[model samples]
Target: MPSEEHTGKSQPPVRSQPFPLEFPGVHYFDEQEIEAVKRVLRARSPFRYYGVDLQGEAEAFEREFAAFVGAKHAVAVGSGTGALSVALAALGVGPGQEVIVPAYLWVSVVAAVVNQGAIPVLADIDDTFGLNPASVQARISSHTTGIILVHMSGAPADAPALAELARQHGLWLLEDCAQCAGGSIHGRKVGTFGDMGIFSFQMNKNMTAGEGGCVVTSDDRLAQRAEACHDLGYARDRNGRLIFDSPELCLWGKGTRLDELRAAILRVQLRKLPVVTAAMRRSKYRIRQALEAFPQVALRRIQDPDGDTGCFLITTYPDAETARRVNLALRAEGIVTYPQGISNVLMTDWGLHLYYNIPSLVHRTSIDRAGFPWNLTENRGLGGNYAKGACPAADSLFERSIVLAIPSCLTRSDEDDIIRAFEKVLREHLSS
Candidate 1:
């Protein structure tokens, strides 16, 4: 048995072999997660929580989570979407305002902006799959209120530059950590770079409570606003009473409270986060080593100045046909791969077309005029979206990219299986 210390630093030598046979599905949860849920069920009050009961756990979690993210404060919320909604509301974003977001992202991100009566200005992603600050700068109108930078798949956005851009332009920043919860850049956490950072604890996340999320900030006033907005616009009075029935409460409020049960589960999960993060890094290296020498497939690109990477493995292809073949091939071999297809509620989706009424950009339009361009490795015979004419670069990645699950609990043998499975898929596909 390899101890954490031994396995932690062991980076396998680069090689190409038929990936090994490993079971396909993920083992995301464990006894520790189960016990945490059990503790929540055993709590004194459980679900029927009040102001202080919820706030107390929130405060504690906020402190711990803030420390984890290297921020001054955090505010736990019901979901990652709720965190965005409340954070925007707390920042006073409303009708007649505009918010900038990447075109390629989880639908909830754009939904949060639109739901708040604000218009979403879509910007194209850069080579790293994050918001292009240049595109952001080009899209800024007088009505622009904020920028929601989603650090997609734990790849940190160009934080320092983006932060400076936001500050220079006097725009609010909301870091979306739905996928990259524990990711950091240059020895700093992802979410803490913006005005208010949001995190999701959805079942599939690196750290999860089945379904919960949080927001973090360094500003005291922002923290108070988040609490008030999440709790029907009620803040505690000096006498420990909710300061509702006041002129302020009448002005702003919403009910998106976090109950005690989720908090209890989260507390235990927080205790396990450090260990989980370490294992995730190790597992990522395992896959990276196997894929390093393969020219037929391109592994997901990650740039970490500190030599760290996210837990999951993402591989991009050149076109949708290749992506489909690779995905089908992997699935047939009992190894699952998630293609980076457009979200269900994208602009072209049937329902979204009617809801947002988004129009297609004109031919040769300046969509990528100010954005950085990036293309995935082309040899994989995967990538371009067969439907959307050609974004050869974006299409290639989205059409053929693969997402493999790597939970923190995987054993060394399991890790080896994952590496081998990927190599097997690539080698077979390449030879064919």
Candidate 2:
């Protein structure tokens, strides 16, 4: 017989361990989008070179998206990078200017500033891995021309405070909506708060057009500026003829314009955004609740000053080492997990690759410097030189973080599989 102490005390057996399970290979598509693409292909009416069909479809998409985001105007572009570039150019950010950005945001946001010949002053993010207005305010100086606030991972970072900071400092605020399209803060849409808001319709985005983007703003002058900038800075007279009749002025602009086919596809997707967003919300909530039960995982809070969130989950592990281990283990189980990209603003966790990774994607003995000039050609007012350093919070969170995709088409089984996978790996790591 066991001692009284051992006999009286009892512990429950652990439930079956959950492991990350691979999701079924199912495709999610709306029939309307397919037919829309087919229609564009059949017409084949000179879709390129900015024709009437392209303009009309682009205009229609712009209107629909602007209305959806509660903005007065929207301008379509070839991609999210193009949208940010034109928006910054419209704001008159150019050489020698500086823009404050969160270090942990997507590299494209920082590149947008650098492309404008302006300097990118990296600011630290708060616990949510987003721009903290105080940190941004502290970074402002005489050369600081703009603030690019990103809603990283679809969580609405505090916009009102940042907007107020920008106003007080006389800084132009450009909202990077690439990750948080269709979201809102304090009942206002995501793209309607700042001087300019840029959205991505890249294939992976919630509102996809294969490869396209748009800029939203209430200011008509800014809208026209962006429109002309994206179209090679050309102006048309009342009859739509080039006003500068000087054939002698032989200057051309780059082609960053959205095509008609993608515009039509965007229109179809735009109509389904609300439905898709709703589904994503439901799945994210369930997965989050399940994941939160494990103390080892720190999920990003959706306290976006915008009240909505969708499709992906970003979470931080206890530290970079743990994050690395869990990510590897999850991958072995066929679960997709990885760190947030390199952050220039994250002084403590600065990873320069996030800015120039595409150009130098593979580690090679010879670096390609040919793309350097082109990479730094656009303007959104990031200029001037300053010391580089580390941001403790951004470094800790970004390096030790994991991002998971929450597809709108996920079924209950898929969601359960995700939850189980997270629980299993997290528990195993924690226990060991």
Candidate 3:
């Protein structure tokens, strides 16, 4: 059997007969990245703690990223989850409040809400694999205080609709742009449309610095709150200079500031993001055009065709059974696809952890052992059941969907192999 390394790095040359195409690895670090890291080390004083240097790589990164996203301020944090938690906390989402989140997203989204002592009401997603505005409206309750819209798989969600919904309900809109750094909607960036937007620079994200995140916002108060929350409630003046002597601390803040080392590395990655995202977009377009012959397969809906970051290519089959069969066939052909069902022990027992399945959240016995947030006196009668069919759209979507990770570094031949594999599989399946 070919090892994972061989499959991802060096597969046999493309041939008439189908051969596995090497998956594009993470962005390669060259002299620029090396120099950035070296410069940080040479400085030896990358700390952002109180009373330390203020102008550093982290600050520079915040400025560059904020400018890139067209936001007035950006607060650098330790990770994407940290950014979410800080943003929620800064926005005043607290105990007894409900924050609507998409059911089909990384578990961290749920965890961030949990960490903030707020309830995460799971909402279903439409074909875009993002929070369905209708589902979001349905999930909104008297207790609902905010909505976290995830741009899943780097495809921009219906931001205009979601934004209007937030306005109508007076709910805070937090855009989770973890998978969509360069993604835009109608020429506007994804992270700039909400009250506050958060981005991830984790290893797998479109723009990465090993592991980091930032919160961007045009709202001055929200930005200051996020910054203070990220740095242990350190008060900041109007100019965002840290104020050490403020008597009032708004909330219990966590120390989740981004360090200088990673920030330095991110500076280099940020410069390369546009080029990488463009390549991924071109790869997606080529694959989509190639698959047009197969009417049985449909690409995931894009709310805005021109706004996709092209980090992932998701398709749906005619039905669940056919989707499962094609998934298996594609794997046999060494083309990776989203796994079907609970295939292993981890997935079987704890698969819900991947997205913190709503049912698990409602009946969280172990984590809520103290009965604090889930069953607290303040939250009594607030907790509800997340039954198996709670989110029908999201449930059905995952079953019939096959997600292919589109690497930014895909070569022309690699893209060709991916297209040919899909065509070959669909031809055989349709013919049979």
State the lDDT of candidate 2 residue by residue for 1-432, as single tens digits: 112232222422121232222110112356887787777677763254444344456667878888989989888899998888888888887666767877656767766765665667767888766788888977887878889999876668888889888888888899998878778877888877789999888765777877899999999888877777776776445443544663432223335788778888888888777777777778888888888677767777666532556666676777777777666555444453224312112222334423223232212112236443224444223332322234556656667787666666767876776676567668767654
Question: Order of candidates by TM-score, top first?
Answer: 3, 2, 1
Give the Cα-based TM-score of candidate 3 against the true structure.
0.88
Model 3 error, position 257 (Å): 0.7
Candidate 1 displacement at residue 277 in angstroms: 2.5
TM-score per candidate, chains pooled:
0.75, 0.79, 0.88
Better of 1 and 3 by TM-score: 3
Better candidate by TM-score, 2 or 3: 3
* Count of residue pairs whose backbone atoms collide, per candidate: 15, 21, 0
